[model samples]
Target: MQVYCTKQHANNGSNRFCTQCGEPLPLAVGQVIDNRYQIIRQLGQGGFGRTYLAEDKNQFHQTCVLKEFAPQVKEPQDLQKAKELFEREANVLKKLQHPQIPRFHTSLQVKLGNKDFFLLVQDYVDGDDYSQLLEQRQSHGKTFSEEEVTTLLRQILPVLSYIHSLDVVHRDISPDNLILRSSDHLPMLIDFGGVKQLPASQGFWFTKLAGNHTLLGKKGYAPEEQLRQGKVYLNSDLYSLAVTILVLLTGKEPQKLYDSYQGLWYWGKEINVSPQLEAVLKKMLAYKPSDRYQTAEQILKNLPLLTATKPPTTHLTKLKTMIVAPGRQRANALVSKFHNKTQAVAKSIPLPVWIRPFAVSLGGTALVVLTGAGTWAVVNAVIRSVTSITIPSISLPEIPQLPNPLGQPVSDKGTKDNTQIISRRQQLEIPEVFFIKMVDELFYTSKPELKGRSLTSKAEDTALRNEWYDVASNFLDKLEQANLSTATRQKLGNYRSQDYEIWRRQARAGQLGNYTISQLNKDTNEKFDRLFPGQQRGKLNQQTFGQIWYAIAADQVSKLKSSN
Candidate 1:
C-alpha cells in the first residue's frame, strides 16, 4: 500500500511521532474502542487525522474501519479547527446511505493512559482509488471507452445529485475520490471531508486557502473560485468533473493542456480530442465557474449531447439501405412474406400415398357385390318355404315354479329385525373411523385462504371450537400409526370434542398412543407433530407454531367435519 505519511509527519510531513505536539503517535493496529471496534491498519493520514481500517466488535464483533482525529500534533495552533472538521466529516458520513458514499455506523472514544478520543468507524470500500486506476491504464497504453466514461459519470453523478439536494457542495471532485471496481468497472465516490454547504444568501459559501497540490484534487481542473478563496457552488465541482472525464477520454492531464496554451485550461488543441467533445470540454474548462454549468444536474442533462459523430462513409449508407429499405417497401415485403409462408406449408404436407383417394372407391364396389349375393340367397329360401306344406299345431309347456329359492323360504319380518340390529352396530363403527378421518380431512381447510376465518354458528365458542379442532387434527396425525380404516381416521377427527372433553376432563390421562392429546395445550414439539405428523421430514418453526396452530383450528375444523 502507499504510505500516506510516516507517523512522524503527524502534523504535516512524515515521522513516527505526532508532528504538532511531538507526542508518540497512538495510531496502531488491533486497538479496541467502546468495546466494539478493533483497529486494523491505518488507511491514510491527512492534516485532519489518521484513518484506520477496523473491525467492529460487539463481542469481538466484525471487520470495519475507524477514522478518528489524528493524535494531536501537539500545540498545532489549529487543533480545534482540525477537531471540528473531523467531527463534521463523521457527522456527514453518519447521515448518508448512498451506495456510492461510504456508511458511518457509530462514534466513540478510546481511552488509554491519560488520553481518550473518538475513532470514526465507516464501511470499508474495496477498490483502487481513481489515480491508481489512471496509472494502471497508462501503464498499459490504454484509455477508457466512451461507454466506460459514460458509466463512471452516471454512477457518481447521482451521488452528486444527492449531495446537491442536501445543499452541500463537494468542493473537491477529482480522480482520487472516484473508485472504479477492478471487476465490474462500476464507479463509487469516496471521501466527503471537502464538502462546503451553500449558505442562505444567493451565492454564499465557505472558502479557504486550500490544496497542498496533494491528490485530493488536481491543479488545472480546480476552478479559480476554489483556488482563490472565492465563493463556489455546484458549478465549481462540475468543472473538475468535466476535466476528469476529458482526461479519462484523451489520457492527457488538464494542466498539460493549460500549460501548452500558456495557462489557458480550456481544451482546444492542447489535447488530441474530437472537435465535438472538445467544444463541450472548452465550456467546462473555461476558467470562470459561471461560464460553465450551474449544477451537476445541468451537466447530466447535457451529457447525452456529447455522442460520437458518424463517419462519412458511402459503404455504411449502402448497408443501411439493404437492412432498413426493404422493411419500408411494400413490394419487397410481400415477396419476403410469401416465401416464408410457402416454405412453412411445404414442410407440413404429409407423404402422398397415405392420403391417396382411389382406395375408398375400390372398397365401395366390393360391398355392392356382397349385398347382391345375399339378396339372391334369401329369394331362393323364400320360394322353398312357400312351396312346402304347413305342419300340425303344437302347445309348448310352461316353465315350472323355480325351486323354492334355495329350497327354503324366509319370514320377511324376521329378516327385517336382524338387519336392523346389524345396521345399528355398523353405524357406530362407521362413524368411529369416519370421524377420525374427518379430522385428517379438516387439516386441508387450514389452507392460506382460510387462515383467519371463524365461520361457525357458535361464535361465542370460537375458542372451544378451535381447541377441539386442534385436538382432532393432532389426534388424526397420531392415529396414522394405528391400523384403522378411513372411517376410524374420520372418527378420530370428529372426536376432537371428545378428546377436548377428555383433555379437560381428566387433565391427568396422558397417552392413548405415542403422543398425548394434552400436548395440544402443552409444548410445541408435541402439538406440532400431532398437527403435522410428517413434520420431522419437513421444516420446523419454533416461533410460528402457536400462531400456525391457532390458524389451523380456526379455519379448517368445520370444513373437515363436513367432508367426513
Candidate 2:
C-alpha cells in the first residue's frame, strides 16, 4: 500500500476539502514537481501537501518518492522555519549514503489550491515495515527470542553509527518507521521527518520539545534527560534502542518492566532480561544521557554481532531448493524418465474365426470347452497324450532329396509324374525336421552374432533358400514332442514366422520373385518365446512371450514354462 491514488477537484461544486487527504488537504493529479518528478500515486496527505510514489518518465524505469506540503498550513510564526526544515531534510538526505538510509533522489513541487506544495521524490523499498514484523510475531503467539533481539540490535547498530557519523540526529526512532528487507529481513532506519544534520561535531541547539518528545517515543524509550525539559544528545537513539529491544524480547512495553518505587529497573519478579544482557540494557537505558552509549559505534564495539533471518515457509523453502532453469536440460530430463525403449511383451494375435474349427483342442482349453460329459474322454485322452510326448533328442539323419535343381515339370500331360512326386514325399519325411532347424539358425544369427549387421545378414543365395526350410523342420518337430500342449503346438504352427518361412522357400527360390522381405518374414515367422516363464516377463518383453517364449538369456535357466 505504498501506492496511494487521489481524485481531481470538481468544477461546479464549491468544495473546500481536498479530494485526496479527506481533510482540507492540498494537492491534485497531473502536477509536475522540479520539472523532473511526476506525481503519480498520492502516498499520503497531511496539512503539508502530500506524499506520492512517482516516476521520472524520461528515464526508463526510474521511480522516486514525492512528498508535497502546503505553505499555508505551516503556522504563521513557523512558516519560514518549516519550509527551511523541509528543504534542510532534503539537502541532508542528498549527502547521506548507507545501507540503512533512504536516498533523496530529487525535491520539487506540484501546484494545488493556488499554493505550491513541496514534492520530495525518494527511493521506494519493496518490503514490509518494522510494525508488520511485530504484528507477525504476535500473531504466532510468541515474543521475539533473545537471539532474535540480539540480532536486530547488531544489524541496526552499524546503521545507527553511520547515521550519527553524518552528524544527523534521527530525533525519532520507532517500529512503524523502520524498513526491513524482504530477502534478508534486516532492519533499516527510514522516514527522516525530524532529521537534524549537526555541523561537523556540533549539534544545533533548538528549543526543547516536551509534549512532542513523549509522543514521538514510547515512555521508557525517551531518556529521562530528553524528557526533563531538555535538549537531546547522541545517546537519545541508544536509549530508544534499549527500550525497543526490551519490548521485542518480552512483548511488553518497556515501562511495564520498571518499578519506579525501587528507583531502578525491577527484575526477577516482573522482568525477564538475563543478568548479563540486563546490565547492558540498563546501562543503555540510564536516566542520565551521559552514562549510556553516546555513539552507535561505541555501542557496537562492545556488543557482540547478531544476525536473524526470516525462516522460510515449507513450500517456499522447497521451491528455493528445487528451482531448475527452463530449457533443453529440463525437457530432456522429463523425456528420459518416460521414453519407451525396451520391447513390449508379445501377445497372441487372435486366430481368425474361420480357422477356429481346424484348431486341435488338446490341452487345458479342451477340458474347458468340453464341459466334461460327452467330449471328456477325447479331451482327457488328448491332454494325456500331449503331456506324455517327451522331447526326443534331435539326431539329424541323412539329408533327403529336397526338390531337384529343376524338378519335373507340372503334369498336365503326365498323371504318373504327379503320383511319383507324391510317393517321394511320403517316403522321405526328413524335410520337416530340416526346415525347422533352418529357422533356428536364422533366429540365432539375428541375435548376438549379427549384432547390427542387417545388410550382410540377408540369405539371398539359391542354396540358402533350400537351407532355411531344410533347418526349419528340425525346430518344429522338437517343439511338437516337447510335452507341449496340443493347443500350444498349434499356436506355434500359426506363428507367422515359421509358416511364412515354409512358404518362403518357393519365393526365395525365385518362384515368386516379387515377394518382399515382409512376405518372407510372415511366411517363416519363427517368433519364439511366446510363452516365456513369469520371471522373465519384461526381460524379452514381447507381448506373446510371457509364459510363452523360447528360452533366452535370463529366462533360459531351469524355468521351463508349460505351454498353454
Candidate 3:
C-alpha cells in the first residue's frame, strides 16, 4: 500500500512523513471524502493546493477531479480571502455551460485529521494535455502542422467566446490547460482557477497569497501586460494561445521562439505556413491588447480556409474553355475538338438565359423544363451541371410532402394514410420576366411611409430593422401553425427559414455588415415590387411584406387545390 504525502510524493503506507519533503501525510489510499468521493491518487500540486484523481462512490464510482483549496497562508484574513476566492471560482464554474469545458460537480468541506479542507469537484477529462502531446511528438521527431493548429483553434476559440460572453477572462490559457478529449479529439478547456470576471470593480478577488496582485499565469507563455501589471483583456487568452501554438509548431519554448531584446517573434522563417494564417497569428500576438482581435468571432471570421497543396481543377474551367473561344466559329470548333475528349464538358454547357432565372429563384431545388422541344435534352444536361456546381452560403431546405387540406384519413387497419402529395403548383410556368417581377414584389415594396422617413441614427435603423424582421418571422410562424397542405407548408418552409433567422439575429446584435444588409435590401425590394404593385403595396416593413407574401401564397395554394 502507498499513501501520498502533503507534497503529493508517493510513500509507503507505514511512513508517517513524506519520503522526500518530510511533510506529515494525512489522507491514505481508498479513503472516502465526505462519504462521497473516494481518493484514488494525487494528480498534481501547486502553490495554492493539490489536485487528485478520485472516484465518486455516489455516481457509480465515476472518475472525477478533486481540487483542494489549501492555500499556504498564515494570516486569518488572508485565509478567509482565499476561501472566498475559492467559493467564487466554484460559482463561476457553475454558470459556465459549454461542451468543451469541464463540468463542475460540487464543492464541499472535509475534515482530514484536525484540519478542515475545502475541495471542489469537477469532471475528469480523459486525455493528454497539449503540452504532453507536444512532448510525445517531439520525442518521435514530429510536430503539429499548420492544418492541425487551425483545427485546434477552431475547436477551442468557441469555448473562449462562450466564457467571454459571460464577461469572464481566462487569465491562464496555454497548452497545459487544454486537454484533448479521447472521444472526439476536440480540445477541452480545464483549470478555471485563474478565471476572473471583467470590469475589475465587480468584487476583486483572486489567489494572491503574496498580497501583491501579481500576475497569475505560467511564465514564458503569458503576455507582457499580464506579467507586468496583472492586466488582462478578452484577447489576453488569444495571445497565450498564439504563444502555445508557436511552441507546438516549433517544439520549442515561447522564449526560444521570441527575441526579448527586439520584442518580436522569430517563428515565421522557422515553419512553413500559409501567409494568411501567419498574418492572423501575428495580429493575435500583438503586444497591445487593442491591436489584437477584439473578439473570438472576429478571429474566426478572418481565419483563412486551409489551402490545398494541389490546385483544384474544376469542371467549370473546362466548360468555360470550350464556350469562350475567339469567335463563334472558333468556339464551335473548340467544342467539337473536346466534345469526344471530355463528355463532361459537352454535358455541362450553361443553361439558356431564360431558364437561368428560374434556377436562381428555386435556390437550386429542382429545374422544371416547361418547353418540350429540341431544348429539352439541353435543359436536362444543364440541370445536371447546375446541380453539380456547389453554391456557397446557400442551403436548400428539405422538400416535404404537401399536407391534405382535409383532415387525415385513417385506414381500416387504424393507421394514418401514408399517401404523399407532391406540389406541382410551383411548376405553373410563369414567364422568366414575370417570375423575377413576382419575386421583387413579394420581398419589398415602395411605401409612402418609407419614402421620406429616414432613420434618425444607425442604432435606431438597426433596432427597427431587427424588430420588423422578428415580426416577419412571427407572421411565418403563424402561417405554419395553420392547416395547410404539405406542399404549401414545404414551399413556405423554404422561404424565411434558416437564412432569415440568422440574418435577423445578427442584425439585431449589430454584428451584420452594411454590404450584406444592402444586398438583402436590393434583392428583397425587387421581389416585393413584383408581388404587390402600386397602392396595394402597403407598408414596407417586414410585417406587411410577410402578410402580403403569405396571402398570395395561400391564394395560389387554394387555386391549385380547386383545380385538382
Candidate with top TM-score is 3
Candidate 2 lDDT over residue span 83-135, tens digit each: 56667667778877764566777766545445445556677653445555555
Alpha-carbon RMSD, each predicted model:
35.6, 38.0, 26.6
Candidates 1 and 3 compared by lDDT, better number: 3
* Of candidates 3 and 2, the better by lDDT: 3
Model 3: lDDT of residue 171: 74
Alpha-carbon lDDT, every model: 0.41, 0.42, 0.51
Model 2, 505: alpha-carbon shift in Å? Answer: 96
- Deviation from truth (RMSD, Å), model 3: 26.6
The 10-residue segment of model 2 with minimum total lDDT is 370-379
Candidate 2 to truth, TM: 0.46
The runs of at least 3 residues in candidate 3 whose Cα sits more than 4 Å from the true structure, single-residue gaps closed, are 1-27, 73-75, 195-214, 307-564
TM-score of 3: 0.51
What C-alpha lDDT, on a 0 to 100 scale, does residue 384 get in candidate 2? 9
Return whichever of 2 and 3 wins on TM-score. Answer: 3
